[model samples]
Target: MSDINRVAVIGCGTIGMSWASLFLAHGLEVQAYDPAPGREAPLRDFIAVATTSIGRPVPADTTALRWCMELEDAVGNVEFVQENGPDAEDAKRTLLAAIDRLTPAHSVIATSTSSQIRSAITADCRHPERHIVAHPFNPPHLVPLVEILGGADWAVERSTALYRRLGRHPIVMRREMRGHIANRLTSALWREALFILQEGGASVADIDDAVRYGPGLRWAIMGPYLTYHLAGGPGGIRHFLDHLLPGHVKRWAELGTPVLDADLEAKIVQGVLEALGDRSIADCMRARDAMLVALASLSSAADDAQDDLRGDA
Candidate 1:
């Protein structure tokens, strides 16, 4: 992080805008750029309105930020750069090469890339060791997990410190891999859910209910393994593993691979539509986002209290 006070956000799409909002809310000077001509105004406004985390209303003061016309101008003096450009490997390599030429050698470069492996993207950069992957969950300002991978150990430490400064939790990946931990876990769940839906065994809403009213509630506080440990009573993990391992394997085997036939696609669309009847997608997304914002605030406060107690102890 190198005590990052200035950050450059190279793309201003949905994820990019959210990253900019997080930076601004934490009082960082952001220089955002997108080559598209009509983007500056709305992107700036989106960031301005997205600063509700600090309880400061929009249009209060965005004097610190200046949207730039060129990528070079946007990143000229920034201490850190959060790249949210296209996910294509060639495009990322090209942009990173351009950034490597312009940005100071010491500045950390983070990508919001969801799937691309960091090692592959940073291979062409001048300062490959300084380039790290910092993938935040959707609406980066609200969700605290920033999945950091690749780079040197020092780079990960610095990136973690910077995210901490911005009121986020940085989870370091032990290895460089595409789709890191969270996304991999999410994909596993999604794959099974899709399979079930495609087979007409479960509706979209039913799957959501299984999560929202069940595991999701428990997962909010502890992960699956810990939850399972708790479920094992006095015997703990050893007992559960001994008895549950076979059943787990058997159940997983029962879930055969899914093929997306025409009927399945139509069923998926129908189920999704039925679950979201009459509600505009944008409106539904907004509602979900607002809820996440409040949840994140509460979680942060809880974590701070825990930290304080540990310090006292």
Candidate 2:
């Protein structure tokens, strides 16, 4: 939205490569950097596979990104930088210092950090005002939501606009909370999933199927609150809450925390491997992510249609 076409991706690991692919798919020039030598070829291969798998257009005149050995070189001439390094505080502090010094004043500095808050990472930066945490789901190129946090209203507004321009849904957090919104919600679900597994109430595949077939279907179009409101029939969410919430809370209270037992961990690993079978984990994740991307695109289209209908009304 700000003519910010060029993007720099620092740390070209799994998340970094995925972010790069998203930018490149949208015809944005990407400059990438990683300390590992010969990583460029593998990164390029990942982009190719992701683009094909997601059915996203990889332009014929596609300018393959410049891979730099130095971090500053990657940030050069770019309007945005998406950092995807290790989650260690010291590592982030060092990287942010360098990015703060090198990046253009107006460039929007974002991180792929899932756990850290914006303030923690950007505290050392000279222009902390220009920094925001833009965390995307795994396979960022595919998932539509980019959770944006930090800065004042203007910073959040600009970051939201930029992500929207890139065809992403940027959910701006009202506060700089740890783990942000999506991941926090995911953590809640995962916590329950662990309880279910530990209680021997559900298998891994059963839990997966429950989501892929049940509430996940409605979640594609609306938030859980809205879904519950609809479930209330003519009475709305308050009525449903009065009747249903007590039972829900009771069930949640009864669930136990997962024990960090080696046997359980081994069983979990075996279960996942059995689910995946011969398919590589990377390949399986990519395929699953591609479906989610298409689902998100469809949902967005539906939202647009509903808005248009409302306007006509």
Candidate 3:
């Protein structure tokens, strides 16, 4: 429901391209900029492929996409900007400052930073209030969760409405954090996975299988808190705290901190390569996207059924 339709996408990396595809699929005009040469071909290819996986009505022609060579040209008249610059502090600071200066006063600038906080990235900008962090999960075109934080109340409200209109589930954080929310949780799990590998407790394939076939399946529907609350049965979270908290604490205390040394890195690389066997990176990505589309369809149907039941109640 955002009145703003023209959007600017700075940077043409994996994240930037994905954002462009999603924005265009939602019927927004996208002006994209990247310093790298000969990027148009790949960018168009990515958009075409992403549009299919998006499972949404996309523009018939790539005419809605305008490739700009200069930063100012891309954001000059756009109503909204989605920055996908490098994660480095200096690079983001410089890029954001430029965007703030070039874009209109009312335009909201959202960065796709996965780790850095918005405040730090916008510390050098003249209008920090106009900027925010809108970190999307990997393959932004496919993922529905976008973690939003920072910006003034108006900017946050506008960004939230815009993302929702685009069929994205946006979580607006009350406070800024280093890794936002999802990344922090994912990092904790990744650290444990690394430890398990280094300690020879499980193979890479086994860890992936345990997650994909186990808790990961449920996580697709409900988060950890809701899942654990159900585990408590009739008594809810109170029973969980009383009966299971001790074991959880014990496991946490025994969690190992494994460094990514050369040996461990080699093991991880070989394990992943062996797991892939004959599949290339593109092949794996295609497979992953196909499964994501199917899962999203199921989740949508379940949500609709729940809504119908609630109406009946």
- The most accurate candidate by TM-score is 3
Rank by lDDT, highest first: 3, 1, 2
The sequence of per-residue lDDT tens digits that candidate 1 reaches over residues 1-313 is 4477889999898899888888887778889998877887787778766786445444555586788988999988987899999988888988888888899888888888888877777778878988888989887877788999858777778789989988788988888667888998998888898888877787988988899999998898788999889877799888889887778989988876678789878888888899888999988877877888778777778889999999999
**How far out, in Å, is residue 207 in model 2?**
2.3
Q: Which parts of model 3 have CA positions greater than 4 angstroms off?
A: 57-60
- Cα RMSD of all models vs. native, in order, equals 1.9, 2.1, 1.2
**1 against 3, candidate with superior TM-score:** 3
**lDDT of each model, Cα atoms only?**
0.84, 0.81, 0.90
Cα lDDT over the full model 2 = 0.81
Per-residue lDDT tens digits for candidate 2, residues 116-211, read: 767777878988987888888877877788888777566677778778877788887777778888878988898888777877887887888899
Tell me, by lDDT, which candidate is best: 3
lDDT of 2 at 203: 80
Kindly indicate the candidate among 2 and 3 with the higher TM-score: 3
lDDT per residue (tens digit) for residues 140-240 in model 3: 88889999986899998899999988888999998877898999999999999999999999999899889999999899999999998999999999999
How do the predictions measure up, each by TM-score? Answer: 0.94, 0.92, 0.97
